[model samples]
Target: MKAVLFDMDGVLVDSEEYWVALEEEEVLPEAVGEGVVDDEEITGMNYREIHGYLDDHYGEHLDIGREQFETYYEDAADDLYSERVELIEGFEKLADDLRDRGVRTAVVSSSPLDWIGIVVDRFEIGEHFDALVSGDEIEGPSKPEPEVYEIAAAEVGVDPADCVAVEDSENGVEAANRAGMTSVGYRTEINQGMDLSKADHVAEGPEELRGLLLELTS
Candidate 1:
């Protein structure tokens, strides 16, 4: 592969639960009226898509507008990701290996820019990636829509077919698939319950991810 696109949460960093908690604790209670927009709704969606889910489920009860919901999520996200999020083991080494092979690397996440920035800064993995595309940077849509991965490929200047995407959730796998790239499933603590059967390859851990990538490119 000429390039690799990585999803942030549940793939590179262990921040998926952080977001789930943020929704359960902060955003949903205030916006969705105490127990609306459950974990299932939050699991596979990006922030914008999450907002739309809330609108569809609990919009009438919200004491705010769509922009207000966005702001609340944005603010909560800032607080949520500020804490030190742990990096997946061996990912640094794997990233270095990919770089050493002259492969371009980038992050294409459904997270907002600030959240991705915090994790990137915390882990100091910013230097490893050639590009970082947050869902917020792209207009109109999120994961499972293909646009996000397409944008990442464009930014990296690589053909979609030449890139492999690493994803943790079904929506992310679908996004990568729709973007015309092979996608490796990244299963982690946060998304252990998720079904990853649709992925091009299933990696149970960071070490497995490294092995899979090398094997695929070999």
Candidate 2:
């Protein structure tokens, strides 16, 4: 592998728990209605695209408008990234390991650049990545559509087929696979039950994921 693209929320940092909590507690109830939405539908989607997705797929069930959905996520962004989340175990070492082996590393996420910035800046690990790719900045669709991962590969000057991606969301794994990368589904406590069948392989936790990436790219 010429590069390793990591999905920031779950793969590199344990932020999905916060996002899922927000979705389950308040976001979904106020936007798409409690029984109408699923975690997989918006977990890896760009925040900006989620309102439209809910409108298109479950408009009849909506209890709120686009503005409210947008407001909920935007308002939660700061605390979720800056306070509730922690970098996944072994990520700093893993990034350094890969880079020492001459492999490029990047954070590729469906989140906007500002959220991503909050993450890297808080962890003080922003220097580890060769590039920080955001879904909001992509020209086309984001995760599950492959454009974000494709762009990440290009930004790192590596062919998509030669890049390996570690993702913790269903849409993220699908996006990496569709981009022709070596896709590894990363499982954490928060996503232990998620279906990652689309991945080429699955790693159980941070240590396993770190080992797998090292071996795959070695």
Candidate 3:
């Protein structure tokens, strides 16, 4: 593989749970009625796009305006990334291993850039990545559309087909596949029920993910 594009929330850090919880407990209830918004529906989607999705689907039932709905998520991200999130097991070593092998690595996520900064800075893993790409940076659709991964591959000076994308959600896997990258589906307890069948390969946990990356790049 010429490069590795990683999804930040579940692949880099164990923060998908925090996001699901926040949506379950706070955002969805006010915007889409209680228990109506499924975590899977928003997983791998950009926050801004998520608001648009909810507004489009559940606008009449919403208790809050689009702006207010988005604000709740933005405020939650500050707390979630700063205090609640932790790096995924073996991520530090995995990143180091990729760097030692001269492989280009990057954080390609549906999250905003500032939220990505929080995780990389907190974990001190910024130096490991050649590029840090955000969904919001792209002009059109984000994950599940391949634009972000396509942009990520370009930013790192690699062909999309020569890169491997590690993702935890179905939308992310679909995006990588659409980008012509080899998609490695990362399964974790937090994302057990989410579909990832589109991936070229599947890794059950962080160690397995490491092994998959090593085997691919070897």
Task: Name the candidate that leads on TM-score.
Answer: 2
Tens digit of lDDT per residue, candidate 1, span 1-218? 89988898877777777777776787778776776555655665787677676677766876656787678767766565666467888888888888888889998988878788887887788999999998887786788779889999999999999999998888889889999999898887777777788888898888788888987765
lDDT of 1 at 213: 92
Model 2 whole-model lDDT (C-alpha atoms): 0.88
RMSD of each: 2.3, 1.0, 1.2
Show pairs that collide, candidate 2.
Answer: none
> If scored against the real structure, what TM-score would every candidate get?
0.87, 0.97, 0.96
Name model 2 segments beyond 4 Å from true. none
Off by over 4 Å in 1: 33-38, 57-64
Question: Once all C-alphas are superposed, what RMSD does model 3 give against the true structure?
Answer: 1.2
lDDT of 3: 0.89
TM-score of 2: 0.97
Candidate 3: where is the Cα deviation over 4 Å?
A: none
